[model samples]
Target: MKRLPGHGLRRGQAVTVTVDGEPTAAYLGESVAVALMAHGDLSTRATKGGENRGLFCGMGVCFDCVAVVDGVPGTRACVTWVRDGMVIERQDGPGARRAAPGG
Candidate 1:
């Protein structure tokens, strides 16, 4: 999804987050999903058969945006905030719960 224009928006402090080891620009208080999407990372996790899924429903209700952050599995990117130096990884198979470093 395209980022909305900055009009009528108030962003927080500047911060840098790492997605799959790649440094990405972000802002404090922004959701990890937003941070990932802002950096062109739309896929967050893989389901059965290696089908990737991403931010769906946006809110915490849908778990499609779940990923790995700071070594924690099943972290809902849409609800988790991004912090400076935060490390995010794309989740592999949900059953395996393995995290891989890449887009």
Candidate 2:
């Protein structure tokens, strides 16, 4: 998932976010979905039957791109902005429970 030519030249400050415990490069103000896609990781979560789901209806009309962010589950990756040191993990299914604070 290569970025459009010249599109990378006008991005916000560079930042690093941890995705699935792996350090992934991202930019401030960029949505987590964009960052994930740019890193060649399209699937954000899976269905109960194990079907992978990713970016869809980029305007947030859909909830197919949900993932756990910074210990919070079911976050819409398409709208959540990336921040330095942000922790992101690909969710497994729709039954994910909210992570306990500081846990």
C-alpha TM-score for every candidate: 0.82, 0.82
Model 2 lDDT per residue over 5-103, tens place = 767566799999988777999988799998878777698887888788999998787999999998888899999999999988888787463233366
The number of clashing residue pairs in each candidate reads 0, 0
Q: Write the per-residue lDDT of candidate 1 for residues 1-103, one digit (tens) a residue.
A: 3568866877899998888778888999899998877878688888877888999988889898888898888899999999999998878867344454452
Model 1 stretches with alpha carbons more than 4 Å out: 1-6, 95-103
Local distance difference test, candidate 2: 0.83
Q: What would the TM-score be for candidate 2 when compared with the true structure?
A: 0.82
